[model samples]
Target: MASDMESDIALHLKADYFDFFDLSIEKIIGSGSTGDVVLAVHNTYPDINRAVKRFSLKEEDLQKRNISLERVKKLFYHEVEMVRDLDHPNIVRRSNGIVCPGYLAIAMDYCPLGTLVDHLKKMTSERIDKFFPGVVAGVEYLHSLRIVHGDIKLQNIFINADNEAVLGDFGVSFKMPENVQGVKSVGSTMGYFAPEVLKKKPSVDPFKCDSYAVGVVLRCLVKRRRPGYTSDYMEEIRSTKMEDKFRYFLERLLCRDPCKRSTMSEVQRSLIEFTPDRYTLELSRKRCLEDISNSSMPQQKKPTHKRSASSSS
Candidate 1:
């Protein structure tokens, strides 16, 4: 009887593979080292769109890769497991997944407006301010769960259909091998990594590292440009005439010592106490646009926010 039950379970798992085939790809959304994300719709719910991430490994690529397939599989499942357990308004939700020979696909909510990176390129400080609280709230929620989002850059932040900033790519830390004894170089982005990570400290605090990245992300949003390295932008920020409190906030985030950095809770408190209002948001946008128009940086012809479907025109 036990043997028969085990066989039944195995068959059920085998049958699950068919679910991935039901997704019809609309277009390629994004691609990275691990796989490609496609805008797709499930056959059962053709009216609604979903983002399907498919992992495919070719023979030549697999043979030339340094990491083993076993390691990659472990990491991928770790991400799925982590995402499956999270329930937050600001975090992107994963719906389902499927696995087959040499391929794996996971479906998640589709963000139609693209990533914060795309918006930041043209958005002014006012527009960035609108999204700032949502970003911090999302990160604060993650830290509350004791899960560190290894990568938290503008590119990983998506704009939902409701015009809210929703954080995605929140589980890249699973890429690390479970048994690694020393500081493993997971190739975190340069400017976003905390100093301890850069030093390859044996036990770098992932939480602190994430907070540091949030600081960089916040700075990039305000500056409306990529903050390449801490050293590269620290001096520039210091020289710029920003509000004292905001400048101090960014400085504390960029603190080299992890212990000196601000906690997400503390950052949230500061935001609530000193949050900029809509008037300030508009004022800042105007000032920033004037500066850009007078400077050498390429200015957008007209950077306008798209009206949300639910909002009055």
Candidate 2:
């Protein structure tokens, strides 16, 4: 809610965040490269649930990473402070933070439905379309504050009890430098890398990079598959059977030329004017079932030649 993103916040002070809450060891909800998240309950508010993430780093881990304990602490609090200060409906809320001897812990709103990755099997055109706006709103809010999410992916997007998409994981986030057009560093997520990033260009626009990642995340959810590393996914989008508006929207986001890429503002504006066509997986499945039921052709006979074979060779 604060327009000034750089304003100092008092949330990340070292304290016993868990002293007032109870963690359910049995309910370990999430595990990732940095740490594991478990379900937590406030001591006074027994009915409410939260996700407590405990970041882990041992002596060798620190040595291998070439980072000091103080540096790790600063980075951990950096993420916590960003999430704690942000007040947006589509962004996950952080409540508390604590630093221990070797690791740190933070508590946040618990989205019972889990993340987008958990619902890959249930994702459809409608579901993907429904959450598209929330992602945009969250990113829009971040950009409004001059902050970049740095990482946006299915695993980082959570679905709450209300089934609304909310963004999480600000560990890799950074504030866009004042008056600066672009930054030299970015998050290390490969599939979500923008054209400028993939090309290993020195200076990359953080805002455009985030927009590119949003497109990839949307594509993976709608397709119910992992984001691919191919550079020509736009061609695949064109060849696929989807609404014209929807197809064009994706093409613009995935455009190889940064100058021609669609910004989040443009995307939000387009959505306001038109609602794209919804997808129907049942129709596709039914057609496939009908073809199989009507034909006796063996699967192996469909293709006769080896893809790698060359007569001249």
Clashes within 3 Å, all models in order = 0, 0
> Could you tell me every candidate's TM-score relative to the true structure?
0.74, 0.78
Clashing pairs in 1: none
**lDDT per residue (tens digit) for residues 222-259 in model 2:** 67788887645787787778766667678888888878
lDDT of 1 by residue, 192-235 (tens): 87777777777766666777888888788777788776633467
Question: In model 1, where is the ten-residue run with the lowest total lDDT?
Answer: 5-14
Model 1 ranges off by over 4 Å: 1-22, 42-46, 57-67, 174-187, 231-233, 243-245, 276-313
Model 1 error, position 278 (Å): 11
TM-score of 2: 0.78
- Evaluate residue 263 in candidate 2 and report its C-alpha lDDT on the 0 to 100 scale: 86
